[model samples]
Target chain A: MFRIAIEMLLYDKTKYIGLLIGVAFTAFLVTFAMGYFAGFMTRGFALVSENPSAKVWVMDPSVSSAEATINMSDSALDIVRGVKGVNYAAPMYLGNMTARYANGDFQTFQAIGVDDATLSGAPKPANLLRIPESAIVDSGGTEGKLQTPIYKKDMWSYDGSHLNAPTRKLRYGDTMLINSKRVVVAGVSHTIPRFPPRPLLYTTASNFKRLVPGEKRYITFIMVRPTKNITPNKLAKRIAKQTGLKAITSDEFKKETVLWYMINSEDVGDMVNMVILAMLVGFGVTGVMLYMFTYENIKQYAVLKAMGASTKQLSDMIFTQVFISAIIGSGIGVGIAAILAHMVSSATFPFRMMWFAPLIGFLGVIIVSMTAAFISLRPIKKMEPGIVFKL
Target chain B: MSKIISTCRDIVKNFNSGEAEVKALQGITLDVYENELLMLVGPSGCGKTTFVSVLSGLLSFDSGVCKLMGEDISTMSDERLTAFRGKNIGFVFQAFNLLPSLSAIENVALPLTVEKRKRVETLTLSKEMLEAVGLDGKENVKPSGLSGGEQQRVAIARALVHNPKFIICDEPTSSLDHKSGQIVMELLTEIIKEKGASMIVVTHDNRIYKYADRIVHMEDGRIVKVAS
Candidate 1:
């Protein structure tokens, strides 16, 4: 019976191919949309995820996400360090600053600052530790962009890998001006980019203060690590009570960042809407095509019924048809999605196909196909076997 | 000479076509004997097809009994009817109704598949049936590629592949040329005799009348006469 169902579906070449395409396109749309959403979420929480050793983060009461941080007074670091369960705490400075290149092109970079002594928040590099009065540039996607020339075509020596290159350039200490002060380029780090793509530059807190001298006690956050016996959430609560500041566990801060973006940014809202629209279009096309296919094959179904095929047998045949379509279509969709993910991984855009995205999309297509199958089954159920005798 | 394979008495069916009651089968009484070729013949809308439908368990009659192999078709549950039909009855159609994606052997293997038989065994039997119907070497050909006569041969093999007790054919050769029609009729009769199965062949082609053991004519939803 399954053989017959498949054969019947394949009998009409045009309809069979059209049905497969419908299912495949739907699967593609679902996976791609979910993949994009996954990328956004990863970028939103990347800062917290990058420093896996940090247990908790201390910031001003208004700080919600990496991008929504408010400057905390430098004194907050000593206060957090004094609280119980604190193994060590250091100030992490972050700010958006325009960097003027050697060729006079100015671009915005997320300047991430760590204390000179500990190098807590910055990307750890062997060459960075060796070089003095120099900064690390994140080159995740700088092949052709503003920072590409600085790290690629310039006089820099290639060192470590591209994501974590161990090289430097600055013929006789080349420098770039950020607020009228020249800073040396030491090395490049291949850290993942944030959602709202901005180039990253790693520097010391002292250099950060040197670049922006207006704020005397500028400390964006104080990253903390708990002792062996204490949990981060418990330590965070104790610190917040002692310093009258918002001390949150890294997980809480990560969630807050994603929520803040979802609520406050129109672009984030648009992305979510796009995902939903893809789902609607995918399901809609598959449903209509399957229904039309079933309608066209009503006579064949009647013939089968007249031949004494049990209702269960007939139902299984229909379900099997849809099941096969969904599986094949989903395989193609996931394959294309993986290829798409690979294509944009090197670009400046934040695109990621998470482990669960494709699985979810595949399951979603199955559900849609099943629904379409039921819709197609209604007409078959009502078909009269007497039609087979019609001239 | 043989036991009764199917019997219908005072079978009636009606349809409501736009406020008018159309009596498609006013009263149909028929009996098919084992190993007999019974042809139901009539003009258009004469209930010949309806009588065949009821006899084959594909149609229901109003307030009448239809018994196949001494079991009442109306008294059986839907599932029982389907199982009975799949196991005991075979059907052929005017269009040949050969699935285009399946080869001749696969179409013949359908009844066994419905019976949940193993694929290898069903195909082996289907191949033999096709060969018996003079479709040798054509088992792998799809219906689309086969000529009208070959397609009808495949259809007959499909109908009889399970060795059902009865076979039903609806205008089995209406679309064929006279030569192909005669060939199909000969093959159908020979195969029925070989299987010892009763058959109800509803057809308008008069050229195949000679193959029938008995012929019943219908007109205006009633049996007009029996010709032998």
Candidate 2:
């Protein structure tokens, strides 16, 4: 009976191929859309997430997410460092600066100013201190997420693929103007994009102060690492009480950022819409194609039924075809999405590929195929086995 | 004297399409014994097909005692009746009814496949049956690739592949030429004798009446004449 199901599916080459294509299309569309949305989730907390050194973040009392908050007083850095469980607190200048490239292209970037003494909240590779006039430009900016190909004056462009290709390494002398102040590129940091999709620039706190002169309250997020034997949650509560500010653990802050983006970002809603629409398209294709194919083969089912095939046997045949198609179609869809994730990530569009995103798409195909087969079974059940004697 | 394999006593069946009700089978009483070929012949709408449907458990009788090997198929559940039919009955159709996508042997192996037979064994037996029907080298040919006579030969191979105790063929040779019709009848009758199986064949192909152990004629919705 299983063999009959498979052979019958393969019997009509046109219908079989059509069914496969419909399933594959469903898989591909759903996976790619959800993957792109997953990328948005990464972008929502790009700033605080990359700096793993910071265990707790202090923000305005009313601020729920990272970007939605007002700037903190520069003196808040000292106030947070005085908390009981605090090991060290750093003042992070989270502000945007207009960068004029050597090629005269002006772009906006998340200009992050790290603590000059401890350099507490800056991200890897910890060598920004080695280069003179040192600053790192974010390379993970593409698809209008930020600047395209953050180029340096002397270094060759990094437009190639794979390990053997030339790396996007920056030379010591390549410089860009930050508000007309000379700022040189020492390295490039690959960070998950920001909510507003801005490129990132990492510089010392003094350089940030020089670049954006005379901002009265330059400090934005007060990043703190808790001392050993103290969890970030306890420290956050204490800091919130003592400082009269909102202090949250890193995970809570990340969750708040994600939730804030989910509610406020129109792009997130649009991405979600694409996922829903793709599912409908997939279901539509699968349902209509299977219905037409089964209708054409209804008589064949009648003949088989008359020849002593039970309803279970016939149903198994149809479902077997559907199950096989679902597996193969999902494989094709996830495979393409994975490949696209790799390619688009290099160019710095936030295309994220989680293991479960494709699984969701796979489940979608299964539901679609099963429902379609169920709808098709109505005709199979209603068919009279005695009709085999006619025609 | 052969043992009785199937018995249908005064079976009644009707079909209703809107307000008009047609008596498709009216008081059909018949008996098919082991190792016998019982042929039912009649004009269009004469209840021959309907009677055979009732006997094979493909259709329900309003009131009658219809039994296959004394199992009382008329009283069996739909699942039980279908299982019984798969185990004890095989059918060949007038149009050959071969799935267009499958090759000759695949169609022949279908009945056994439905019964959950092993693939290798089913295919091997199907090949043997196709060869028995003189379709030896054409095992992989689709029904469309075969002649009308060859298609009917494949249908016969399918019918016997499960080795059912009783075979029902509705006009199995009516669409074949005279020579092909004679060949099909000979193959069916010889295989029945070889296996000691009972057969109920409904046909209007008088050219092959010589092959029947007994011939029953139907008219309107009742058996009018039986010729032995």
Candidate 3:
């Protein structure tokens, strides 16, 4: 019986091509929408997903996510480092600074400063500690737009003033003036595109001290790593009790970041709206296409019923046919969507193809297709078995 | 002495439309005996189809008693009636209503499959029935691919595949050409003789009356005459 249903569906391919195309298009749109949504959310928290060393984060009680700045005394780091079951802790300085290049291209960048000896503890390179008056920039920010020219000279002049040359051109790297001090680029790191989609420059605490004098030895946050037999939350509680500040585990911070993105990020809302629209479009396309397909075969169904087919058998046949169509059409749709996502990612699009996005999209297509097929049962139930002999 | 396979008593069917009640079958009572080919001849707008539908347990009468093999069919539930019909009653329609999706053998095997029989046994029996109806080489062809005569032959094979105790045909050859109609009637008669199953066929075509063991003529929802 299932074989019969399949044959019937395949027999009139030309007649049902429109329906197949409709379902396929719906599936493609749904997958594309969901893929983009997942990509956007992941990128929104790339900083949290990539950070490896910081087991707990201490913040002001008012702060909710990484993008929020919580002011705390520099003494907190020392107190956390001295606690039992504590391995190491370091102060991290974060601020926004405007950078001006020789070509009159001005860009706002996040300034991150760590103690010279404890740079590795905060997930920064040791090379950044050795390069005085120099910073490491995020590669993704510069790789495409600012194709800096590579030069081997030890020194270079920007705005007719001599500054130490960058060790590497570093994609978007350039000699820039920060608060009347020259800072060269020493290396490039993988880009992290969390809340603020801007270039990042990592420097030592000494450079921060020199550039912004009398700024008070105040760090925005602290990073900590625990020793054996110590959970992050327990260490965080101990640190909080001793330092008079809040301490958060990395997982807690990640959850807060996601919540912050959902509530505060403008793009997140827009992407969610786009996903809802895509689902509606999918429902519309599938419903209309499948309804029309069943309508065209109404007489055939009547004939089958008149020939002594039970309602269960007829309904089962119809369901089998729809299931086959959904599988084939969604398979093609997801295949196309994956290729499209890859192409977009390779290009200049701010998209990431997470490993789980395809699975979610495929499941979405099946759910939407089954819903459409179920709606088509109304007309089938109304079919009269006696109509076959009327003609 | 032939056994009485089906009996209808005091069958009455009415149609209601906007406060108007129209009588379709006025106390139709008839008996169909074993190993006999009976034809119910009637004109348009008569109750021949309604009477047959009630007899086959496919429709409910307003008031009537229908018995098949000494069991009251009118009181049977839909599920039980369906099972009973699949087991003991076979039907052939004038449209040669074979599913276009299935081949001739598949169409013939439908009743057996509905009975939850093994596929091998069903297919083998269906193939044999098709061959018995003189459709040996066309088992793989769908009804749409066959001619009217071949399609009718497939329908007859489906009706006979389950070895039912009785066969009910509604204008079985009405859609065929004269020669094709004659062929279908002859094949049906041959099958009834070979299998010893009683048959009741309704038709207005008088040319095929020679194959009937008894003929019942009807008018205005009432039986007018009976001839044997």
Query: Which stretches of candidate 1 lie above 4 Å from their native place?
Result: A2-18, A49-53, A60-62, A94-113, A123-191, A198-217, A227-252, B1-5, B20-22, B33-35, B61-64, B118-124
**Candidate 2 structure lDDT:** 0.82
Select the stronger candidate by DockQ from 2 and 3. Answer: 2
Model 2 has a DockQ score of: 0.53
Candidate 1: deviation at residue B45, Å? 3.0
The Cα local distance difference test for each model comes to 0.82, 0.82, 0.76
- DockQ score for model 3, please? 0.29
> DockQ for each candidate?
0.48, 0.53, 0.29
lDDT of 1 by residue, B45-164 (tens): 888887787777777777688899999999998778878888998888898887677899988988888788988999899999999999999988988899988898899999999999
lDDT tens readout by residue for model 2, A278-334: 779777987788777778888899888877789888888878877887788778877
Question: Residue-wise lDDT of candidate 3 within A24-116, one digit each (tens)?
Answer: 777778777777766666665565566568788777667787776755677767777788877877777777777665443455677778777
Q: Model 1 reaches what TM-score against the true structure?
A: 0.82
Q: What share of the true interface contacts does candidate 2 keep?
A: 0.67
Error of 3 at A148 (Å): 9.8
What TM-score would each prediction reach against the true structure?
0.82, 0.79, 0.83
